[model samples]
Target: MSILANPLYRPLFEILRSARNGIVYGGKLRFSHALVINLLYKSGPLLPRMKSVFEATKDHAQVLASFAIIYKIAVHFLQSDAVLGRKNLRLTKFLAGCFGSWIVYSGHFNLFNGGITHQITLYCFSRVLLALGKILLDKYLVCFQPSFINYQGDTMLYKNLNGHQQRKLKNLIYNKSWKYFAIITWGLVMFVYDYKPQYLQSSLRHSMTYIYDVEMDTWDTWREFLGI
Candidate 1:
């Protein structure tokens, strides 16, 4: 049976699909059209507000990633019945994921000086709003129906498949090796862009320098920006 046919898993699958779509599409826009618009066209009354919003949400990438990972782990445990008898496991998992991600990411990659009180408050509030929105939508939306597949008795995919094959299939889908490689490659690319902004198109370099206030000609500003 297909995983999407299972009611219990369908919502989670949809959520994951939506997340992946947003990451791909939104990332492309950020690097291309959005970057150009923000740099060149964003001005007048709206520019300050836009900048403020960007600053507030600048360090939220790690927090969002942490939330996704934790949410997946929590769903896994819930589906496997690992925490069937445990009370508050869901809450604990959520808190741990949020706080742990924030602490690790902020400590290592924090670029701003002074305190992070505002950032922490904003992150927590954003999470709360997201949870509330999801709950409301799930409750009111009639489009999501239970999967026709029998998720309790047979495996999600290829019910007749052997245990080893099922495990292999699961591993193929959930393996982290490729994800790590992608992350490393992305990090290296970002490092290059930051280290040598001049390598990019002149317009983009100027825009980036303007927004980030980085002096690409010298190491002193870069070091200071990195808090080294």
Candidate 2:
């Protein structure tokens, strides 16, 4: 117990534990998603159906687990020797993440065509990019920070706004901003899909093509729906 609990071994313990958690979490999440999407998009022999699900599950779980292990190792390595003489917490975390991500992106964990790994990485990148943007907004564009987040500051003009006006501005920046962003995004994506669908990811392009470009003038679709 003492040896396992020793600080010297803490990093190893953390890496193992994180890897286990990542495998369980990533497998479950991808299994549910792949099952539902396959049911909607494809139907065939039981072997292929099970194979696709199992392969996707393995790829997602492996990527997550490997990333967890790599990140822990990288972070600990950085924290070990302050080779730079001065350390930044944000730098340590960001660099460690980048290290782990690069190893994964270099085709280490994924063994298939890698579309799933690419999508997963892109999803995480977009989310981290958004959160980083919000952090910057809070730091510099402090007034645009979400209403729900509280902080201290009393810049001169900030003191002049009444509660109602403050709430309104916060709503514009925090809440309605996303609503409009989505509206604009859908409009833009549809426009792009019409003219430059090749620029879209294959998954998105195929889905959009099926949804938007399929012949609606046909009674065939209606017949299928009606089981005719």
Query: For all the candidates, what are their Cα RMSDs to the real structure?
Result: 19.9, 5.1
Top of the candidates by TM-score: 2
Which lDDT tens digits does candidate 2 get at residues 1-228? 697889988888999999999899989999998888787777787679878988889888888898899998888878766542226667888888889877876576454347766788678776776566556655654554333433455343433566886656555666655676668879999999988889888888988877777566455487776544
Q: What are the TM-scores, per candidate, against the unseen true structure?
A: 0.29, 0.79
Backbone clashes per model, in order?
2, 0
Model 1 Cα lDDT, one tens digit per residue, 1-228 = 877799888767855764565445434433454445655555567667566445434433334434455555554555454555346666756655655455443455453322333444444765676566555544433244222233466434344445675456445533454466558866875686779866654444566566666555455487776545
At residue 17, candidate 1 shows an lDDT of 67
Model 2, poorest ten-residue lDDT window?
Answer: 145-154
